[model samples]
Target: MRPVPAKAVTTSARKLADALRSGAQVVVLEVGREAGEGPEPRNSYLAGHLPGARFVSFEEDLVGPRTGSSGNSPLPRASGLQDRLRRWGVDDDSTVVVHTRQNPAVATRAWWTLRWAGVEDVRYLHGGLSGWRRIGGALDTDVPPPGAGSATVRPGSLPLLTAEEAGRLAASGHLIDARAAQAYRGDPDRTGTGHIPGAHSIPGADNFTGGELRDAAALTALYAAHLDGDEVGAYCGGGVSATTTVLALASLGVEAALYPGSWSAWITDPTRPIATGARPCGRTAAERPSAG
Candidate 1:
């Protein structure tokens, strides 16, 4: 198998189209939230998606069952993910591209999860379906038959953080809280309010401009102070949005660890400290104000 290019974390729609046209062994997975309420949410992929792309459910394929106390979107069991990857036709050498029509966070979650499951050469679709449409990429409603894949899954390809590790990183290194500024500041009405003590608030949405990832120079500026060649980690409500921060850092050639059982899991233990306010002392970013 050919080696994946260093830092080939994202791909453009046009590039993907050309690759597909050339008969490159690529697996496109459309990640999206399930619509409607009730026990069974409607699959969003049924509406429309990129041609030859399989639907990866936000509620099902990407995460594990919640154990009440576990974070809402717990990392899916590795064995289960391996099975799904095979069903998606992901071979050891196949390049997997994930995209979403809703929040980019959903797509990032799939990217992060696939990496965690040890699938090399996984890339997120830059600008998502809209970007594909901009290039006149076609969408289809046909669900491709189950793929015949022999890829094996080995978890821990990427860095991960436990609750204790996250706490320690916050004190000694950069532990970015990737929730909204309002949520990070402790909205009383919200369920899981406030952030981990000593964490820096850098909302995941800030990583993008007009729904696409910011340029490398802009991202570097956005995270200049925190990426001082030191340990950096990110976490959000349930580790979903935080992947955006991790993805952004990856774009800069920075490997930031992710806390999968993030704030939701943190709050499960009353002993864990929660900080409320704009920014912790000595950890303020002028570019990130609390008023957002």
Candidate 2:
């Protein structure tokens, strides 16, 4: 692999297309939430996607138990992700490139999870599927048979912080709240979510200017404004969007721990404090989850 401008963050559509044509062990994955009114993403992929690309399940592949105390999309068990990767044709040496539709936030989840699972190289297509189309990269409607990958896998490649550990980091280090600015400020109408105490509001969407990720220098400078020598960490409504924060930091040669249980899990326990308003501060009282 030639040197990327930064770490495992960005990949060009041309490089990916060339890699596919060269028969490199490259697997492209289309990853994200289901769009408002299309066939399911798998069906969407069947309709059109990069050649040999597969659809990744947001619920089954990357996230774990939905009912657990751990938030909406908690991190999946290591074994679950390993199996998913294998079926996608990922091996120890396979280069996995992931892309998303509207935002790279979800795809960053795949990128972060693949790297955490110890894949040698993982990347996010810079402009996502739209980028591929913009570059005139061809798409195929044919779905390949399932791949047989026997790659050994493990977790812990990337640092993960539990809800408890994240609280500690927020108090002592940099903990970024990656959600809409309104939600970060605890807009009750949006949902019953709020920032953890001592967190800085930096929506993952803000990580990108226009529709693509910000350049590494800009990213580093953006983060540098709020941080000062403390280790960095991030969390969102669930754990998924937070990986974007991790990826953005990784590009700048900074390693950010992820709080997989994020605000979702944090809100589950009434004992856990919740903070609100523009600036984060200690919680006054635990708010109850709104009844449906």
Candidate 3:
């Protein structure tokens, strides 16, 4: 009911097909990890994918080049995004549906970026291609010709956090480390892990089970337990999974800032303190991070 209670996610694959059939200026985008878990998911798209769906590279289209202290998937430049949106035929009123084969992070990243770039009707496909195929949707192999869209991007529709603001959030407000529990607790296998001090551990995996996000009531309860702050923010290995947390927060009517650099950037400065174990620092007035 009401699209699963989140403004950002669509729960029914068949309903999405209905929208496509009705001709609602909709566009489907497939995205995946850059290096990928094994073979990249886009390879499947190359073989056959959702009809009219275009592939958006997580590395090329979604993220910027890793500059000083930048993470693996930092936010892409708005001008570059504007050009890409034009190529994809996205406009101010376009309904963008982003999906991924591996996980929801990629889709959520694209959804958040489009919303941040001021697109009003962005949503994440509930179960991805697997769900689409299950609902009698058809796939096509041919790459559709690019549409000539004139959508100009205006940024800052959503809140953003720099490395400095993130540090303050971890200390003074609520900073969530949206990574695996092991990573949050400094897993020995991952080099340079151990979350930012004062941040809370909230794995992105908890938001979804078997590729479907939990219901609104469940999410509200899950988040209310850990969150009761004036401000809230999120970060992850890079910037991808953090969007899931942002989406989760949005479902509960909470707004959270994103730390695009996240852990990868936090570790760049050898001098920064690292916190290990599950407990949060819980400080009220932690000093803000200074720009070097």
Candidate 4:
């Protein structure tokens, strides 16, 4: 559906309210840290949910096995994902709106996943569930069981990147690392540190202001400052966090692609080079930061 224009994309509460008042026939999809006990939804749902929100867990719904850390998400088998969506009552025409816990990175993955599954009209609730509650939105505790009718899903090309792709991005001045600075420099204490070689950091948190997305002008300004005239490709620890950067670029109408495997996949390659310690702007490995 090309996503109803970025401006038309609705917020969490407003979308829910619209669904109820206008009976827009949309499905509210909540992405939480974990799945709740039983099929009756969880804390978010019980604590006043939108009229028809169905909750799903990040671990159970968003990803599958870790594969010994080779791949970041390692998408679940197509048949399994399809069956689960069918159980969730999603169909060909369902306007599936996804909400997560303010982690734009994780939420973007869900958005990308659904889109990759051929589910059009998927949108992310700006600022996620927390923002909805802050705005005093209404909620429901009822857990609607999955409906009948199977969802036939056709998997599309996964937008994941490989080591060679990362290398090309590095050489072409395009790769972007979306991790915090401490982590981006290969901080020893952090589980994963150091960014893709030639990749520059542009933290995803820059996309928001006062807990909501900043205006489009701000977005364009921010990205323009960091991108350095390269086609942007975002990546984080395991591609989960990088999606947030991709979303921000989208908000600015930038043609940025996401490296789904991201750092996790990059590090796993063993053949890829890893840079350590901090470097100043306009500096690469072995280049000392100028004191000027």
Per-residue lDDT of model 2, residues 39-58, tens digit only = 56576676788888888877
lDDT of 4 by residue, 1-292 (tens): 0112353333556656657688777777877663443364356556666557777777787686777655667666678788878878888777887876546656677877776677766777876777777767766778778865355777763354566776677667567787787677874333334666677777777766644567778877777755455655778777777776766666655556667667777777555666656652233234433445
lDDT of 3 at 189: 37
lDDT of the candidates, in the order given: 0.84, 0.79, 0.80, 0.66
**What TM-score number comes out for model 3?**
0.89
Where is model 4 more than 4 Å wrong at Cα? 1-12, 34-44, 149-151, 188-192, 225-230, 278-292
Q: Which regions of candidate 1 are displaced past 4 Å?
A: 1-5, 34-44, 187-192, 281-292
**TM-score to true structure, per model:** 0.90, 0.90, 0.89, 0.82
**Candidate 1's TM-score:** 0.90
Worst 10 residues of 3 by lDDT: 282-291
TM-score of 2: 0.90
lDDT of 4 at 268: 74
lDDT by residue (168-251, candidate 1, tens digit) is 999999999999988888843343467877889999999986558888999989999897777999999989999999988888
> Residue 76, candidate 1: how far off, in angstroms?
0.6
Candidate 3: give the clashing pairs. Answer: none
lDDT ranking from best candidate downward: 1, 3, 2, 4
The better-scoring model by lDDT among 2 and 4 is 2
